[model samples]
Structure formats: C-alpha cells, structure tokens
Target: MYRRTRRAVVTSLLVSSVVCGGAVVLAPAAGAAVPAASCTVTPGPNDTYVTISGEGFTGPRKLNDGESTVDLAIGPDGTFLVKRFQKNVDYTVLAVNEDQNFIFVNCKKVGTAATPKPENPQNTAPAQPGSRRDIAQGRAAGNQAGTAAAAKSCTTKPVADKSGQQHSDAYWQAWTQAANRSFNRACHTN
Candidate 1:
C-alpha cells in the first residue's frame, strides 16, 4: 500500500527525465548534446569512488568520501537538485526511479543494504576483467539493457487470470521493482 503510492508519486516527479542504458553506452538526449553515462565505484566501505555522468547532470562529478545524497542538475534544464536527500555516504549513482526522482536510486552498497549474500564490509574489487562474476555481470547488463528498452516501449498486458488471487504476491511486488530497475539501467542514471 505505502510503496504503491510512493512509486506513483516518484514516477510523477520524474516525468521529464529520460529513463533509458548499460556498461557505458552513450546516446544523444532529445535536443541536447550526447550525454556521457557511467558509474564508477572505487571499492571501500567508507571512501567508495562513486561518480555518475549523464545528460542533465554535471559531468564525471567527483563525490566526497561520505556523500550519501548528492545534489545534481537533473531536471529538464539540467540544473538543480529538485529533490532533497541527506548528504550521507551511500553507494548511489545518478540512478533514479521511474518518475525520475533520485531518492529511490537502487545503488546496493555492500554492507549497508539488505541482501542474502555474504556481506562485504569492505567494498573490495572493481569489476574484474573476465572472471565468472564479471561475465555474469556483463550478461546481466545486456539483459537489463534489453529489458529497459522492452519496458519503456512495452505495454502492460492485462492479467488474464480470472481468479486474480491465483497470481503470487511476489509478482505484484516485483513488477514495480523491475520497472524501476529498467528505468535506472536505461536512462534515469547509473
């Protein structure tokens, strides 16, 4: 209930933001210069290097060691932090929600966020070149690129299940998550 309303609100706020993306694909903004895009994460729990450059944002901007929330020029004209988030240190990039709000960026820092994998308090290792994890990550990035495209142009088909109760709650829950992820991957940001 709460999430639904929040997503709706967030989505509305980011309407003018272009939500589209991958490792480092550069694309032209509607009427603006081609925006640089990428998220670089320097490994460390405290001083993780997190820089995001995109269309409306300032380029390759360097973040402080403990910057959780960053002010960015992300609006239509590309100047201002329309949203107010604390300047704490979190591993977030320029990624944003569907409505384009920066508050819901899905940056999953190693130790701070919830996860099932063994926690790494030290944000060690920049992505390796050709390791298994690296390969999987490449695949996931490619898949997410496709998914983001499909989702942006993809329309939601009506659920055909007559009972309505047959569908698992997980499906309902994940729908928004998928959309947000796709939006982040494709255009909103890193």
Candidate 2:
C-alpha cells in the first residue's frame, strides 16, 4: 500500500511539473559532427615501395594491414604515413580511429601478383656486372634514403611542461625516446 501511494505521488508530480512548464529538456548542439577519416595507398619510387597515408584521424588509431592487423599510432595533425612499405605483395590498409570509424585502402595494382617480380625489371636492357662491394654500397644508400625520409616525418616541436615552463631532463629524455621510436617505425631501422 505504501509503495503504491509513493508511485502515484511521483507520477502525479512528474505530470504536473511537465504541465506547468517546469520540465527541462536537453538537446545536442548543432554542427557538432566529427569529420570522416580517409586513407590512401600509393605506389612509391619505381613501384619498389608503397605508401599508406591517412588524414582526419583525430585521435589514436589502429592500422590493420589486412593480414597482420597491427595497431599503429596516428600523428597529431590527424594524419599518418607509412612510407617505404614493400610492394609486389598484396596489401589492404585499414585505418580505424578511436570512435571506431574506419577507412580501408586497397593497393590492388601495387602488389597483385602471387609470385613477386624482381625489384629491377631492366634485365633485358642492362647486363652490367656488380661486385659484393657495390651491392653493400647500394644497401647502405637505400638505408640512408629511408633514414632521411624518416627524419623528415619524425620532426616534432618540443612540448612545454604542464606548468608552461622549460621541461626537465627526464621529460626531454622521454620525449626523445618517443621521437626515436617514431623514427624507427617510419624507417624500419629497429
């Protein structure tokens, strides 16, 4: 009996409040929609490599390489680049943002063949002999090129401390480590 009376009182109060314009309603603000994420896969120099670029990812994101589905962090400018990704092998890049919005980019032409072709297809045009030393030098040059690209991508502004003062040595050390990690990821040096 007590429970029934309490329920009736609560219902009457709610109805009266609404009728007397005492009720408050909430609504979402207009134009608060988030921008959509997008991604692209493009062929790199001489079709030897592929690059996966993404934009509009506003937060930490995951990259699904189709096969491996590894999670990769996106950059601060709502963009990320996977440079020098090897070509001649099928790859579907999927970028998923924190909100679960995703965009898939297919590298159909870049790596469609089951059996990969040679990196240099100028077999008929050139028969120039090369020594082991030349091969080593070529590898070194390629590494340097990759490092250069990674350096460009890894450049970042120094972060101010929470108190808006100069950062401590420990903070700088952590920042440098993070930058190094980003460089390694971009250049595949690690």
Candidate 3:
C-alpha cells in the first residue's frame, strides 16, 4: 500500500507540471494578431483640415476615397498640426507601415457665412472667394487634387500589409518574439 501511494503521488506531480508548463507555451500565441498601435483625427472649423494625433504611426501615407489617394504629413508622437481641409468628406488614411493600418475620419463643412443666390431659393453663392474660410477651403481642395499625383508615386512601392508573402516570415518571427516576451512577463515572475 505504501509503494502504491508513493507512485500515485509522483504521477500526480508529473501531471501537474505538464499542465502548468503547457500554459506558458500557449499564452504567447494569443497576442500574435494584436495591432501594434492606433491614431485619431478631428476636423477643424470650416471643414478645412483635420488635426491628427496618436502613437506608433509613421506618416506620409496615402489618404484615399474610392477614387483618390493623397499623401499627408504625419508628425512625431502622431499629432497633425492645425491644417485646413475640404468640407463634407470621408477619408481612409492608410498608414505606410508594415502593418498597413488604415485610419478613417469623416469631416463635415460647418459654420460658414451664408451666401446669397439670385438663381435659386437656397443660398449658394460660392462662399466669398479669397476669404479666410475660402483660403482654408482652397488648401483642402489642393490636397484632394493631388491625390492621384501622389498615388502614382506609390506604384513601385511595396504595399504596407505585405500581402505578397515577401515579408511574412519576418513579420511572424517578430510577432512571435513579442508574444513570448509578453507571455513571460504575464505568467512567470520572480
């Protein structure tokens, strides 16, 4: 009876160790698909440009609608300087990075002085040309106009997401390393 009890105890200890050790190996896999970082943009007055800020973003990326893509500056620490933008637009800003994260924002033109129109009941006189508001609108329009020109610049470039398997090995290796580091810190501590 004594020998049998000892054998049972040893088996239980071995089983427990295996179960606990497996957890450490399995934990890192969970974070493999996690996004590295994120960003946000808010539209300014007159629907000119938006102020963008966040972390883990490197800019000079393409901003696209279905028809166009524009290059825009991305500041360090992810803050976009006060910039003028066009009114009532939605943009899909694709970050030019290994992850190919796309940031989206919708801006509506608001709070402009009413224009008088003799041709129709709705006030639609082109917002006074060369006004401060108009200047902002012009700047925004310039960005919209240049999108196609900029996308042409990217024709030879690698897509950020690396859909072609060119960088898959490297990305997976890095992701695994990061996940292991996170798992060790989360599950095993001295």
Estimate candidate 2's alpha-carbon lDDT, on a 0 to 1 scale.
Answer: 0.49
**Model 3 quality (TM-score):** 0.28
The TM-score values for the models, in the order shown, are: 0.21, 0.35, 0.28
Score candidate 1 by lDDT.
Answer: 0.39
Which residue pairs in model 3 clash with each other?
A: 48-84, 48-85, 49-84, 49-85
Report the lDDT tens digits of candidate 3 across residue range 1-190: 4335434443443455466663212111444652344444555543445654444445655544334455666676553433425323443445443233333332223332343222542333444544544444443433433343334543332122335333234343443444344333443422
Best by the TM-score measure: 2
Those runs of model 3 whose alpha carbons end farther than 4 Å from true positions after fitting are 1-43, 46-56, 82-84, 97-190
Q: By summed lDDT, which 10 consecutive residues of candidate 1 come out lowest?
A: 79-88
Window of ten residues with lowest summed lDDT in model 2 = 95-104
lDDT of 1 by residue, 91-145 (tens): 3334343322232333333333322345463434434444554444444544554
RMSD (Å) of each candidate, 1 decimal: 22.4, 25.7, 31.0
Report clash pairs, candidate 1. 11-99, 14-99, 14-100, 20-186, 20-187, 21-186, 67-88, 68-88, 68-89, 68-90
**What is the full ranking by lDDT, best candidate first?**
2, 3, 1
For model 3 the local lDDT of residue 181 reads 41
Look at candidate 3 and tell me the lDDT of residue 83: 44
What is the C-alpha local distance difference test score of each model? Answer: 0.39, 0.49, 0.41
lDDT of 3 at 3: 33
Residue range 119-167, candidate 2, lDDT tens digits: 6554334222253433443344344544555766654422323454343
Q: What ranges in model 1 sit over 4 Å off?
A: 1-12, 15-27, 30-35, 45-56, 59-68, 72-190
